[model samples]
Target: MINNSKILLVYTGGTIGMIKDFETGALRPFNFDELLQSIPELKLLDHEIETVSFENPIDSSNMNPEYYLKIAEIIEESYETYDGFVILHGSDTMSYSSSALSFMFENLNKPIIFTGSQLPIGDLRTDAKENLITSIQLAGLKKNGKNVLSEVGLYFEYKLYRANRTTKINAEHFQAFSSLNYPALAESGVHLDINEAMIKKANRRKKLIVHKELDNNIMVLKLFPGINENIINQLISAKGLKGIVLETYGSGNACNEDWFINLLDKAIKNGILIVNVTQCIGGSVVMGHYATSTRLEEIGVISGKDITTESAVAKMMYLLPKELSSKVFKTIFETSLRGEML
Candidate 1:
């Protein structure tokens, strides 16, 4: 058992690490080594800190599965040395990246908290410092001599949420993230009060497992009222498409037309996994609750049960390579692998 908490800060680039040029007033990358220098308050935190940076930090729009593997490998390599980890990432794809990491590691016994700011750390009223500082505090949290957060989480705007349950909901607001279907695991108040009951405690008896095989041959098809068969067929039959996150109508409803059902059924029979997620930000996909969605349930569509689009993509990428049978794939997709869904 580790007695002391040590945190490793992983920087993967984002607005949090950017600074505006005094002359041109344009944003540019700042040296991550200066992180502590920028936030001297970090020296006041309880835990010892170490930092690492990617060779090249790209914008979150450039984030992909390869980067996800690199992040996972870094944590795996330092797993034993560090008590917990905090990843500084771009808020644009933070949810997707964080959610992917949640699935990559099984039986994680420490906090891997992801945080970033809507404004640059150098800004007058930036959210970066507080987010980073408090995330470290949460990472170092222990109870009865055991780690508190033994799961991946996204900490932003004073709330720490299950990573897989988060979504980047706003671009201009300091509160850019939201975990609608789930309660926050911890909230940073004057006292840093944690929701003890909401934390996911891991069984330390189990060894950590890292999964690297993420297959990205999947697509998300958002349903619209007038979506035509031609576009549906084109999307379903895309070359090398292995799975589809069908963003269905409310309550998992879809067009009751024969062509739509036939198109999806044929795709399913062709070894394609189709998972149903509601387009709404809130609410679960209760397929048979409505008459329009009954055929979706009958046709073997897997319910996503209120998972965010980012998480559904991450889950698909992680699970597509396992080559589970179509039935097994459906069963597992409906089940919550991480705390991604209800």
Candidate 2:
């Protein structure tokens, strides 16, 4: 129990933020007051907890760049006042939202833990209470006068992972997310065990710089065995398109057809940055590793390394508005900014 630490809970709507009305059995948004009442254990935690929520709670499917900006604004405005932040978001898009925020904040020196539950908070066997409680506890964690976690993390079913390194893999299980490429930062059991060696320590010497400009003029094109050429042609021609996350096959291989290569080549020449990320959930994109992928590397395709598609999309959105040159963007995209990649 960290005493005197202030933890801010930002509820941007999710099953975790819903409580069933006992009388009518209808789910309604749980206000901060009712939140305390529903989970009395929150009161037992020694930290000073404050909460803010979206006026109109929305499902995770409705999450977008605009909402990402809104969430960042909330944290930016209160960054100096709070010790840490725990965002209660829908698990469906938690990885994306968390990844986007990881890039939005530069040089963050405080915990930003994103968490939500598969079941509503009001359910009898809900996992919400534990998720919410432990997230707050993690957010308030401190060691030798410094915050324990300084990067964006996603905590669920007792495991804490770097936010951008995560993906929601299950729909019905309590453990709905997984970070296959990276190890868990912490695990909750009899004791909250944190992997100090794995944590991303913040550079406190630098002040936090929040980046609010995000361009969503990007699309993710997942390649399959028989993905049509016309589909590729139309997608590249999307108006004002700035980037594309090409979800390639094993080790970033894609269709070897000349038409496929030419279409992408044209897009790159027209100033669209295409990043080659592995479609497989748990591996790195090593472009040029295979004969099929050799041309992708030769044609200026940026390798996403081991980044998750969610993070790749978030990274693309974050970088698109920066107006970096094709070469510089490739260098930066391939490099790790927030521990999002290897």
Candidate 3:
């Protein structure tokens, strides 16, 4: 392996790599050959840089586990040669993609930083340059002759957050992502400020294990005040469903109805793993905290703690293939396989 720091820039197509078509007033993908030509400042960083562009870039909305696996494949294939990776992605599903990657790469020891712009790079006032440049700097960052930020992260609006902890909170703002329950891994200002104390330091001794078996045979059941039995029963009875992310109210609270409880209880007994995640953004799921949630707890609904819905779905997809027993599955789901929850 090469000793010097080498950062691989992977462009899978996003607003950050687009240029405007003045004639049509539309955005177009910029070529990889023009990457360095567009950003000469990259030459100033004290690290070797390489670029890899997908044949046809995907919009973030079109993102799925297949693409997630493809990203994991890219990182695995280049893991030895590159010191770190910077993924250019669209903001719309950036959190979902980043979260999936976090679970996909086990024992990761290099930064896989995802970043993109709300505005196209060709725009005069674009945020793409700043986000991309700083992300590269972060990917190349080292301390005591070892990599810094050895985990999946999303860098936007000057903050680098744990990938699984983030959620896309807005569409029109430069600061589009938020990790409410987790502090940023790093912040960029006049200088890079990595909160070393909170960093999930890598156990470099273990080999990286890339998991590609993702099962999307799951559904998200978000509860509201007037949600009825017809809707709940139909979903709980999904023909091939393997799991359900029950987006409950505060502290994993759900409706206190006999029919709802019966539907969920039957689903769990029939091998559907139900994970009870709070719909609120910033709190943990205290399963039996109130009478409303107590029924869910008694019915063996898995508590998602403080895990975000994005991460919850990713976790279910990643873990369900193991086919652990009902009790074992619930135990593992409550545990922090990745640092996705408290």
lDDT of each: 0.89, 0.92, 0.90
Candidate number with the higher TM-score (1 or 2): 2
- How many residue pairs clash in all the candidates, one count each? 0, 0, 0
**Rank list by TM-score:** 2, 3, 1
RMSD of each: 1.7, 1.1, 1.9
Model 3 weakest lDDT span, ten residues long: 1-10
Best model number under lDDT: 2
Error of 3 at 167 (Å): 0.5
| Cα shift from native, residue 319, model 2 (Å) | 1.0
- lDDT, residue 331, model 3: 91
Q: Give the distance in Å from residue 176's predicted Cα in candidate 3 to where it truly belongs.
A: 0.3
Model 1 ranges with Cα > 4 A deviation: 1-4
Q: How many clashes in candidate 2?
A: 0
Mind giving the per-residue lDDT tens digits that candidate 3 earns over 192-277?
A: 88888878889999999999999999999899999999988887887899999999998888988898899899898999999999
Encode model 1's per-residue lDDT on 180-299: one tens digit a residue.
899999888877767879878788899999999999999999988899999989988999999999898778888989999999999998988888998888788998999888898888
Report the lDDT of model 3 for residue 29. Answer: 86
